[model samples]
Target chain A: MATSIRGRGGIGPALPLLTPAYLWLVVAIFLPLSAMALFSFMTELPMSGRDWSLTLEHYAAFFSSGLYVTLLWASIRLGLEVTLWCAIIGFPAAYVLARVLKGRAREAIFLLVILPFWSNGLVRIFSWAMVLREGGLLDTTLNAILPFRIDIDLMYSYPAVIIGLVHSYVPYMVLTCYLTLQAIDNALIEAARSLGASRLQTLRRVVLPLAMPGLLAGSVLIFVPVVGSFMEPRILGGRTGTFYGTVIEDQFVAVFNWPLGAALSFILLAVVLVILSLSAPILRRVQ
Target chain B: MTNLLGKLAAQAVLLSVCTVSVHAAELHVLNWKGYGADEPWAVEAFEKATGHKVVNDFFNSEQEMLTKLRTNPGLYDVVMINAAFTGQALAESLIQPIDTAKIPNYADISGEKANSPMLNQDGKVYGVPWVWGLTAIAVNDKSFETSPTSISVMWDEAHKGRVVIRDDAVEAIQFGAIASGQNINDIKDMDAVKEKLTSLMPQIRTFWSSENDWNQMVASNQIDIGTYWSGSADRAKTQFNLPVSLVIPEEGAVAWLDAFSIPVGSDNVEGAEAFINYMIDPEFYVEWVTKVGAPVSANEKAVAALPEDAFNRAVMGDPKVADRIQFQAPITDEQRKEYLAIWQELKVGAQ
Candidate 1:
């Protein structure tokens, strides 16, 4: 351990490199987390909103809790759905960009894809609201064609949330896949063609595999945050259904149960870790 | 499985850092959105009275404010909570009881608004009475073609798909109980409420959860009538040229009082109290009343000083709607559970 600490260079040379990160982790992440964990093992005094006894009641409550589990499952399901849809839709657009667009034109197209991503998340969601509401853009289009009135409701439903998530994440997936696809040597494809390999076969055998790393990274970036999200579900998800975000929010807000909220949050973190660990082997094979 | 992560760049660890700060010259307050703007006259007066930086943050709901408190125990020194939530927050010892002696300004507030049976419990005050409003029948006169005076109008089949009620299950259930001619206040028997409201749920156009949602629905003329606060109703009428009118149904309405209090974990207790004291001054109270036009229980001098139109808008309508508004009292735990259970059923049953 001492050797490991002293390591690749003299201690004096390495100390500056370690100091800032250590200070940051301690002040910003670890300290709050430690307080949260400590509180989870304690009992809050009723009406005080302050902890009283150092017990495991919160953990006990969480382990046997049906609400938390169901909400967790719902959140995971939504995350996976978002990830699958982003890839399916993003793949075709990314292919056209990577294989077709070149040089300055490609750069312009890339900026166009990221432009909407720069807008505030809330602004983008509400802009969709104007299109999806009862008398909104889609409604206006549908009304102009029909002979009579047909009221079709789409707002405040799961499909609305799905659309919002897909819209938000498609850009991210495209950028990742585009970068990976751009790095492929044109000579490799020219050689494959000369060696009697078909276009489709070359894509399947070479290009797709090369781009897998980008796909994996983008999926992680989108999935992890979306799984624990509250705003998207609250704004776009139908009223009849909710996710883990709502449950965690309620524990803290309605019930004043911070310890439970912290415990539930960590539980979500563990589940995300499990998912990533399980997928690592597949990611490696693609690489 | 391999698609789990899409490669882009270095992993970004988002650190949403929060720190507790204390300042003698500045005071931070958490209040309802749009309630903090000062009256032109009051602004000039308050600056002269106290040399402190007064700032405010708006929360969407009482629940949102409480969530901020839970995340960082001492993040906010003062928060606005309704009576029902305040009792629980006080009981949890999450909030500090108000010592009126420290706030001489509080003494100037009228006994009716300050020491009302609704604002006072067990002789220990935990909040300063701020504003009062009620959830009543907000009707689109264009739909009814007649003035509305009862909650039963929301149940009419003719208005199906046009009726809008608060998305709050508890409030909706209480309306169901009242419309069905049962006790609206003590919701001990939820079965009766569910039996009555389950049939009415389909009639609802949308269970609006926020002012924005309800406003948009009303603006588009999708929903014609519903229960809403006077402030929201007035905004819809004025801004969108909506034909909506707030009515105190013959069955009466549930009155609400939102008050400000210091959290028990407050780092700057003295600053918070001084801020709270500043809010009740006749100058600030009059300004708040003029801007918000919500019913306020304040010193007789403050109430007397407010524009008559503003005071009238808060209490009875210009023509006097009703005098029988009932406050939602802090019920027993059994009552709370009953409300929650009935609420769950209503939530599931609402389309």
Candidate 2:
């Protein structure tokens, strides 16, 4: 590890090479984050020409108001639901691609799975509306074939939002899990089989543990954006779509309350950090 | 080869210089989708008539437009704002008074429409009146045996699970206020409005944000009844062959007027004024209303020029219908906060 840190030379020689990337991060990430933090403490946007003072009223409002808390909880639950669904659906598909499938068919199928990522995300979510609404393509198609007629009015519901989010984000899980699963040696699995270990036992005890990093990476990737997503929920979930992200969006776009939005965003960031810290121990152990 | 390359470079320099000068003269407008100015050939005509090119941006809500105008001053030369927002715009000085002298077509605007309290505030014309419409009930005729003419039709049990409403806080609260026999402009009791909205919550299939989404839902038979703009309901009926029709309910509908204004810090005021003048022209107004299917214009000549049956079907044509409309008034900051809070609570309570 010491030699690894030392690299070809020492820290001094590497410093110059790393400067550009670190500088870019400072300019792009750190600056905006710092500005957002500062803005969170303001009473109003200074540019709005309102008589303003630095106040904690914005943060206090978050704690004082039950609505914000409820929405935040709803958003957290949505993230958890979407991330769980992505994992449940994605892991098996990745396993099949990495282990069972091979060559040209695997390549083509993998491309097909991730082809959704190439299209505009908003367009894809809107397309789901065409299929999910009452008397929509799904309803019409199912009614045409099914023995009994049933209404399939799913649009503007919670399930619609989840479906849209999962569709948009499942590709991330599959791609990550596939990379890690493919790296696992075939000999290890064969050895486990030779030792009379069941496939389920090997999967639970061996494959899962090794693939934990990819799973965690995918979870984090999916959860963070999902928590902050408002557009998908708005387009799909309708009135039932109101979440912490949408509230923040309303503050900025609808209410013109940038300071309050910044405050809410900061609080969300805090919650996310806490979640990441809590999960870090298990993730490190698996690594 | 070197001589040829040098000549090409010289030509490139000349071309870029011309482009830069033309770009500098461009007028940037922030408007709503299909709000009179960007129909089919509006922008092209404007560009051809004036040497200045027109760049357009769009916003769905008045609040969104306000935010854009507030944050990025001078970015937009012309903006189409609602009557409800003109007061705040004036107070904030986000927009400036139009020079009626420069816009000769301002004479064509009917006295009654031009003198609306929204367009002229404190004796200053802050906005050029454009299009006006009513927020009314859109119901599929096939859904009801008899035409439902009341706003209470939304809360009717028969329409439950098949009704949609606009996802706007103020408008939603207004509906509740109107239903409960309270003044929508000045709410004496917030709890009453809350109770009214909450009671109707179960009947609503969803609250839609966009006119397009609401219209499509109604057109496709996904929703049977909803509250939507007059123009969109008309479009969905005529264009999409939907059985949907708009009716001004007995409880009255909210009236909104969109007008053109030059932003405070705009350098291209002349270009913006020219555009506004062009918009109110009788021929342009007729063409705009025809393409857009909106029933009202500030210009009297345009209304007269419309087909014979158009007025009979429009809210503005009937004085009784027009008088009943509750024109959206600008809310105070405290009131705005209250309205939004009430809306947020309504959402949470429903969940």
Candidate 3:
């Protein structure tokens, strides 16, 4: 259709069709981002009756306070830890679904793996709170069958945050890895095996390298959002949940510091872009 | 037959147009859920009698409300602002002073509740006190032998890892200020306040931001004692069947009053005042106040109308409850920034 349309009018005819979508993107995405950037430089919101002035103080405030840097580092570490766990857990499950599992069982299990995506993320995180709190499902159930009692107070702890985040994001990893793994030809694996490559050797040399793109894609998907997430950490980490994202959340809703929040958000955006650019070489290899 | 049907349709449309013209005013109310007497019957009756439509929008917190009010001027006719922050709203010109002439029921407000510092700012009335409650301690009866006598119990080593403090930056820092025996409204010593707040970090099982989180934590036995709102504790005990008892510790507790304020650029000033008047109507306000578990009815008639036992349970009945309460005062901007900074440091240090 594109070729026929081009043959008719050298792309001018298609411009009208594409303008609406591009215009929407520019209006919806670009305009708000630009406004946020502008707001970050302002001393006060114009809506507040205060006389406004452009200043670098909002950005400078980040550097002046060591606390913001520490929180940002903490959020980065959280994203890394969560992405690592997702990869570790999801890659194996994806491997099983793509290779070891077969037919109706595989399909049913695949659906089960992705089921978390269908429910409300907030409600799902809340449900994890129910299961992880002390004397909750995990503790009571373990005590019910076991010979001895054990206490489990995972809620409001670091592990609880990790568990909640991994549960929320692992599906992306599994879905991505499965898509890549399924596309791998069976004959190539057979040839590797016939050539006397051990199962572990074939997996390490062929499977992993072949699957790197999906893993990288999944990592980026999980890492970016997790770094900016406040809700999960607030609900699950409790006392331990103060990260860059939560602080930014506080600045807007709790502190009523819009300029500072915008500055922090813009900084996060820059960091994400840099990270993406750094990973672009490997992402290119995946294609 | 077609001409007759057409004539009937025209008459029906004319009747609807006449009805629409009668109810020409709309008051956009921005408040927390159930801030007003929003019962269907009360709303319907109010609409019918006043010929004004009340459209309500909700926000979760004071800061959230301020953000919305600032960003969208003229979007709201009336707003429910925490009494403490009414000054902030006025300073920012987000709200305008109330004309008591427009709200004749203003006379119905009790003198003391009317004199609440939050309702009047810079010698002008910017807000009308609506719902007021105590910020006190909620103790699990199963854990405490007797009612915990003091706020010091919150920092007692025995209760470490079993106490839930509010996640609010200002409140958390103020708790520390109070712990250090500093006047909560006047904290001149920042370093000392920070040290005092950091000292309590170890005792916090978690810092809860939402009432639901606090409720679940207390009711599920995850927290033994907590810095909780009076209404929340009451519901946990009565509704959730939790073994929780409310107390105002010896060190005093933070109390808050949420009030109605007209936004700066309200489109329907008369309609807004009418709605505010309707909110304090003894019959409607009583049910509304009871439903929300708010302890105080700012209206004198509503207070008189409450059952004797009900009034006793309400914070208003306990005369000493007022003596024990330190109403939250609007903090200076510098203090606000310092409080958040210190709270952040405490949070990070605790981890």
Candidate 4:
């Protein structure tokens, strides 16, 4: 298949076809990243005739202060927790959709899975606040059904942040896992059953390994953004929301220290890259 | 064919001339979204009276505002700047000094506000005083038996896990400084301020960033008390129907004044000045304050024109309250960094 396509032009026709996408990547992604990298080494923004010189102080500031490193670890932990929650909640839903449900019902449930993407993210977060705050929907409903009074004030706490993030990102896990799970042959599962494997063992040894790529893909998609999210934590985490992303946000909008913000941003990018590289080996094996 | 071409040429010439005239009469304004400058009626009135159209752009924060002015020079004719940042704008030459004599309404501006050091340097007025407001303590009326008068209520153990404050480094540090009896602008004892802020952390339920956040938290009964803007507090009470009371604590409230200035390289300087004159006029101020809950107007006559029980007049009109008000001073970049560092450390420690 590769030789048939290439035999016509010997990479000549493909160059023009691929140029626009590569150009876009260079213009949209690389240029800004390169600018940010340069900016991360500056004393001040090289605008408005302000006297500025090349400096390593901004990078040094990050290392000298323990606050940034601590917050970065906190954000990483938040990313991991949210990713795990998303996997737990989404995998089963995907399984039911891919295996148990039939044509029209499967389509309806699939639509429901992706429904959260239709609305604005901010609106969804605020809706959770409505449900999570004291005297909110969750609290009112619980108290009404039960004989005794109970409080369910989860707003502005760490758990609330995690819940909001997981709610926002679970759709990615569902979509990715559903595709892979649906591709697993019924014959293979039947063969496992005929070989005297239990339902749990069949899922553990056969189904899980087959769905690894999709699970890993979904985890990566959810993990990266969750690590750098400022708005979700700010709205739901309350005082506890001061993670690495929020601190970087302050450096730009609140503190007007763009150089330092760029430095911090570059550091975050490097850390994310390292994480991705570490997972590349496992991802390659699954593929 | 010649006649048909002649008619087309004539129409094209007339269209180009009209376009040039309309473009010359347009003024680009930079301000906060929905803050008096872009009010539909006010814009209509200004355009009708001056024969110049107004176009507005918004910035969410003072830092973003500076960045816009810095990056997009000559794009904006007039800008609304907080007085605390006017000095920085002047130092960077982002905004040119206004010719107050060109603005007819400049005479009616209150002497204290017009001559404020933040807006003036070396006897030249850089920013024309427009409006002012207070960052004071606001409490859910049901939570307090009697109106709390001191800022200490934020640190009161009874309100622990029910108290909130703005998540701003400058405001938080200044609030802490005031609570610790240090000057808001010049804090000689950083250790004391840090101690006071660190102690207040446990009492904080969450930090509110935007006015919407404050209203949602307060309305839902998640927070009983917190630091809030006086103008927003008024709106929360009157518009949102929230039972919020704005308090001028014994230690005085943090005050901020917003001003209008012409940016450097503005093509329509005359139109910008006229627009600013309209903005500060008693007619505009009175209509804006009465119709939309607004910050205190810089025009004294505008304040007097309000009904006796008007929110701004009732709360900020008193001379005693005015005397105690600690208007925000220009924050140096170094000082800002230091304050932010302290604020970040405090938040991290709390977490």
Instruction: Using DockQ, give the best candidate's number.
Output: 4
Writing each residue's lDDT as its tens digit, candidate 2 over A1-287 gives 65876886688767888999999999999999898898899877777677778999999999997899999999999999999999999999999999999999899989999899899988999899999988889999999999999989898899999999999999999999999999999899899999999999999978998888898899999999999899998888876888889888888776767788999999999999999999898779778
Candidate 2 vs 4: which has more TM-score: 4
Q: What is the C-alpha lDDT profile of model 1 across A1-287, one tens digit per residue?
A: 66876785668767798899999999999998888777667666233244378776666655664656766787898899999999998877788899998899888988888988889999998888788878888898999998988876677777788888889888989989888888889898888889999989998888888888888888998899889987677666545445777656645654445667777787899899999999899889779
DockQ of 3: 0.65
lDDT of 4 by residue, A145-206 (tens): 99998888998899999999999999999999999999999999999999999999999989
lDDT of each: 0.70, 0.84, 0.83, 0.91
Q: Which has the better DockQ: candidate 1, or candidate 3? A: 3
Two-way DockQ contest, 2 vs 3, winner? 3
For every model in order, the fraction of real contacts preserved is 0.20, 0.49, 0.71, 0.91
> What ranges in model 3 sit over 4 Å off?
A1-20, A279-287, B1-18, B21-25, B40-51, B101-104, B116-118, B121-124, B265-267, B289-292, B309-319
Q: Give the docking tier of candidate 2.
A: acceptable
Isolated chain B TM-score per model: 0.78, 0.89, 0.88, 0.94
TM-score of each: 0.76, 0.91, 0.91, 0.95
Per-candidate interface DockQ score? 0.13, 0.46, 0.65, 0.79
**Candidate 4: CAPRI quality band:** medium
lDDT score, candidate 2, position B68: 84
Comparison by TM-score, 2 against 3, better one: 2
- Candidate 4 chain A: 10-residue stretch with minimal lDDT: A4-13
